[model samples]
Target: MNLVKLSELLEVSRSAVTQSVRRLIKKDLVSFEFAQDNEKKYI
Candidate 1:
């Protein structure tokens, strides 16, 4: 899901979701990609 959706579902701020994603990325646990259909990034 995208950051916005994730934040909404988790009831957290987008910044919080971003920080978590960054940590996961550092550990190679998750990665994000740009959607060709839109400018949004997905995890």
Candidate 2:
């Protein structure tokens, strides 16, 4: 989910979601990719 949607879903702040996502990325539990149009998708 996008940051805004994720924050709302988790009832957390945007920064918190950002931090958590960063950690998950570092841990290789999640990954992100940017499309040719510059849209980000998480996998």
Candidate 3:
């Protein structure tokens, strides 16, 4: 999900969500597909 939506669901700041997502991306724990607007749902 987008950072804004995720932040709301998580009750956290958007910046915090952004940082967390960034870290996950770096660690290859998260990914996205712009074409399908997919989210990071690790398997």
Candidate 4:
């Protein structure tokens, strides 16, 4: 899901989700890609 959806689902701020995703990315646990509209999609 994208950061907005993830944050809404988790009831957290977008910044919080972004930070977590960043950490997960550094650990190679998660990754993200840009959509056609340039939105980031977490995978």
Please report the candidate that would top lDDT against the real structure. 1
Please, what is the TM-score per model?
0.92, 0.73, 0.70, 0.80
Model 3 per-residue lDDT at 24 = 87
**lDDT for 37 (candidate 3):** 50
**What is candidate 3's TM-score against the reference?**
0.70
Candidate 3 error regions (>4 Å): 35-43
Best-to-worst TM-score order: 1, 4, 2, 3
Model 2, position 29: C-alpha lDDT score: 92
Residue pairs with backbone overlap in model 2: none
Q: What is the C-alpha local distance difference test score of each model?
A: 0.96, 0.80, 0.73, 0.87
C-alpha RMSD of each candidate structure in angstroms: 0.6, 2.2, 4.4, 1.7
Residue-wise lDDT of candidate 2 within 1-43, one digit each (tens)?
A: 5677888899999899889999999999988766566576544
Q: Residue-wise lDDT of candidate 1 within 1-43, one digit each (tens)?
A: 8899999999999999999999999999999999999989999
**Candidate 3 residue lDDT tens string, 1-43:** 5667788899999889888888988999988545355654322
lDDT of 1 at 41: 96
Between candidates 2 and 4, name the one with more favorable TM-score. Answer: 4
Quick one: best TM-score, which candidate?
Answer: 1
**lDDT tens digits by residue: candidate 4, 1-43:** 7889999999999999999999999999998877887666756
lDDT for predicted candidate 3 compared with the true structure? 0.73
